[model samples]
Target chain A: MANDVFAKSLLTRRQALALGASAALAGALPRGALAADEKVTLWHGWTGADNTTALNGVIDTFNKGGKGVTVEPTGYDWDTLFSKWVVSSAGGRAPDLVLFHITELPEFATRKVIRPIDDVVASSGLDLSQVPDAGRTGVTFDGKVYAAPLDVHPLGFYYNVDMVQEAGLDPAKPPKTGEEFLEWAKKLTVKDASGKVTRYGFELPNTWATARWIWFSLMYQNGGTFLDDKGLAAVDSEASQKALQYLVDLINVHGVTNPEVGGNKGEDAFASKQVAMKFIGPWEVNLRMAQKMNFMTAQLPVFGAKPAVWANSHCMAVSKQPNEDKLAADGTFMKWFFDNFAAPATTVGIIPQSKAVRENAAFTGTEQYKYFKSFVDDLPNIVYEPLIPQYLSVFSFDKPTPLVTNLQAALSGSKPVPDALKAMKEGLDAQLKKG
Target chain B: MTSVASQPAGRSKARRASAQEGGAVRSGMTLAAYLFLSPYLALFIAFMLLPTLAAVGISFMRWDILGTPEFIGLDNYRQIFADPLFLTAIKNTFYFVFLTAIPMVVLGLALAMLLDQKLKGTAFVRTVVFLPYVVMVSTVGILWGWLFDKGTGLVNYYLTAIGIEPIAWLKDPHWSMPALAITTVWWTVNTNMIIFLAALQDISEELHDAATLDGAGPWQRFVYITLPLLRPAMALVTALTIINGWRVFGQAYVMTQGGPEASTFVIVQYIYLTAFQNFEMGPAAAAGVVLLLITLVFSLAQMKLMKAI
Candidate 1:
């Protein structure tokens, strides 16, 4: 087996072109035989300071677990990672372990690039008691676990305490309704004499991620589903349109926030204090909450319905190896890493998958940790982004998502809410039909 | 031709052994020739040629990345024409080509002419203008994004200084195409200008002097002699720009993101999103085949019109 593994590596360098072609074919096929000691190569889209922190955190735990395995790590940016992953998968040289966006997993799993982990999980007997049930369902595909949950990073509403106070609102207990929030946003929103905005109430993003986040939170709160059980675009209903219209009103008619707020990133605007309040992922907890500026955290504000927040989980999956022994070892490494290592590190800004780590004493004492822990129970209540293979296409190109087309119309008052929703529905239907 | 070919009996034999001196002769294959050509030919076949062939095959089938490709002859192409988005992509691509290519060639030629004269530090001036061409696409896109950023952008700042209201260059559908055109031209003109400059220099000074003596004005000489001679370069640059303009992805990816109401969406960005983002490689491949055919025909037409072939 060792000789076979050695030969595989040697052959890989000698015939790069042939290997690439063969690998692409093999990637989509059933698992082949294994080498005795499999070295699982893990590629992640984490880099820079955060990437270093994540890499060191995972590597330390994996190495210390004493599983008699080796894991090689490579990191690139998000888009590049996807592009490389696809090309590599087609070429048959993909990594053993990969960390992809939760939204992207459905398509990748369908393509059979990553394997199901049900057998590995059941054999390893990893406890699932502490992990959120919502997160588990998010990574599960076709009734099998193809990925292990690392953490759920939900958007936390970070507010400037100074602005909140000046607006006659309690920083401890934020607005409970859309009207109250709007009132406070208006009061906190500062403008110069000529009506040029000196400070914005909220910085909206004209990108898919932001628009989807806002639209989902509101629609869920207003009792709407983005897609029906049949996987059709269902956001054109009255409730959904109303929710979308409210966001449009905030920009065009309400006059509370800058109409051009979606021009740049909302989080940056909030961090720079150009905006008083903004919805941002929990990853920013370390960056903003630790700052000297007086700030407070709250659940995403309620509009019409119950309190529901948007959430996505980061997942760890073993990359498929050519040899069978290596596959088993890769599985063992995956089980060991998820069971032991990934959970604790995730608590810093992420909710861990290990049921044991959820209420661990390590997380119980910190103030921010306590705030984050409160939402752990809300995991089941949290919504997942679209899990379809064509999900990214829908966001990036399908014109229905306000991030691409309706945003300018919404901002410029060229297209009304109904027209935008209609456009979105038509575009989404076409894409879904194409599938 | 026959006499030239007849002189190399011994030379052809040795050249056959060395693989250096024969045009039509089967030379003894040199180890170096094989060594140099092997890697490129292998890569070309594996990456470029095979994929191109595969794309043609895939275009006839119905497949997404996840599932096996089921053959459905011409169905993908038929569906492509039926799909409104693909049609829109075609229109948007042509719109982008016209918006970018025309201004690029005209501005590039004008700039070449302006800098063609005797001037102090002409080399320095040429380098400065062409610098943007060498910068990474991401950097160029991000810089333009910042410069065109609504409210706070330098462009807006200057416009407002003159009492004109700020324009949301990337956020308005009416304005997005124009904004993208301006940016595309700014990043690409330097290369074309350099090419035009070289072509301009190749024009005989004696001809210009003769035309001047005949009392032909600057525009007349340019129209009669310079423009006619520059056609080959112009044709080449225009064809290249058409291809490049159709593949405008990075700018859209970075700046408007095919946004401001799908005003800046181009074919390549659509193809990328379709394949990688959608995991629909079949459609993406089909889109590429369509683009390849269009570009080939257009390029052929260009060559024919310019009589380059």
Candidate 2:
């Protein structure tokens, strides 16, 4: 009878162990095989030191909140990320979220690679009014919000204080008008005994993308339009011609900048004190700070009838999700992303699109922020790249964009401005037709 | 009589058995060889042949990568012919080939002849000459770009020191092609030199002795004997140089980016831009097909000429 009882006890013990094993597996499933947390993948092209740090901080904070959503971020260079996005979208393997330039929103939206986020915005009760007018317009297409505006970076004046002081100009007050700018440039320019320019007073980028942006800003400041009523090329208009002439004169006539060292070299010249002033995006603030260079920011001098600067925004967009659950998770993440937009703006040295962020002490306390306050006050005058889907094909530096090619020829003094402008119009029209 | 018939039947059965055993062994060997080759064959079909065939099909469609491809039927080809940039690209490609190929052949032969002489450090000389060929094209391009920079370049500084004004080697449209050609020749001449050196080594030394005895001068001996024997190597090198010249992309892409005004824009750059940047797969495929045909024609013509020479 004792042997029988012992066998029964052994059987009961085995059964209990089996039940415990199953229960333990069920308990571990949430952390392992059957993760209950929603996985959100984000693809971006933010490789700048500060930009990456800011992005990682936002992601880390979100992940640590234990919101049942894990964010996976992938970073690529700008060109590579764009190509990957294209291929992935076509292959139906796109990430849950993507960060793109506001300029690219129209194309992405029209191609259906990204979904409209109107419902998410309304559900989250997010105030869209905080976004700058230009940022809002940039991310909107066909009466719908396609992306959440993150930050606006505009072309502004960056000058070396030492260089300015050496040129006999007050470092505190920079050139505010076209005539004063020209006079200061002439005074600051230095030449060696061989008549070669050793130090340029002002530097303009020779590359197509940057040169085109500067040209566009100048045109807008002069009340010029890139497209007519029918959305056709209007590069031959009088205002555009004047802008082109002004750019040409900077190199060929005024001789303040050298055409040979025009692209990235011009930016380097400013950093290395080879030039007194340069017009570049606001991101240069952090870059110069990292270099430990003494530089200051100011609004671009009024070279035309009005004050205008070229600006673009980086925006957050949701890719086409596979299911309602994923979509809701993406929407939740995007809402949180915009709510905490100030983190990136303060860390990355970009002007905040959100009014609340702009007013936040985190942004207003920085010396760079104080210097860029004038640019912020001039926000209403900023001009954006055209929102047309064909804009990239017309202006991309990677491809042979006719406008850029012709502009290069003109800027390099290879062709007359009128002839280049005519060619640019013709080429732009052809490209538009092809599209 | 029964024994004789049985003997013949037994021989026939032995022959049949031997033939069956040999056939089985041969079949088994072939199966094993195929198994070994299957991996390479699978990769080639998947990566090369399939993509090429797909490209041909895609050339007939108007696909912008984002949307489904719509069959357009030769419109891409028609557009390429009418496009001025395509024409310019073709012209530039031809110019590059013309400028680079002949110099590579002549310089390669000259260098090989010099290096073939019994001299100290021939091994070192060979390694030095072939070094650029192994260096990465992008690295060479960047190094040369700095060397040719307008303001602070070593080349410009030397030129200015010599009382010649600094030339805008990369900025000027006319000079950009020549600059690129120089870089290409410097990078590629080693391959041809190695081939020529091998061919020179293979030529019998007794012929030169005999020619010397026959009152032939060094130049005459080279022209009569060495040149004729080196024809095969020259033919191969000429074809390779021409193909390499036509396939030039990296130097121009990294150094000048087909500027100051698309002056260095070659056919391959046009195709790359069309496909990746513009996302026009059809036009890019059309450009690729055209480039392939052009390269094939040039190679065949050069081969025939080399054979005749």
The most accurate candidate by TM-score is 2
Q: Give a tens-digit lDDT track for model 1, residues B40-102.
A: 999999999998999888888776654578988877777668866778778888888878888
For residues B1-309, write the lDDT of model 2, one tens digit per residue: 686567777787887898898999999999999999999999999998898788889899999898889999999999898999999899998999999989999999999999999999999999999999998987888888877766667888999899998877877788889999999999989999999999999999999999999999989988999999999999899999988888899998877778768888899999887887678899999988888889899999988877776
DockQ of 1: 0.27
- The C-alpha RMSD of each candidate to the native structure, in angstroms, is 8.1, 7.7
Q: What is candidate 2's local distance difference test score?
A: 0.82
Local distance difference test, candidate 1: 0.73
Query: CAPRI band of model 2?
Result: acceptable
How close is chain A of candidate 2 to the true chain A, as a TM-score? 0.89
User: What is the Cα-based lDDT of residue B159 in candidate 1?
Assistant: 95
Sliding window of 10 residues with minimal summed lDDT for model 1 chain A: A29-38
- Per-residue lDDT over A200-236 for candidate 1, one digit per residue giving the tens place of the 0 to 100 score: 7876666446656777788888888878788988868
User: Could you say which candidate leads in DockQ?
Assistant: 2
**What is the i-RMS of every prediction?**
3.8, 2.9
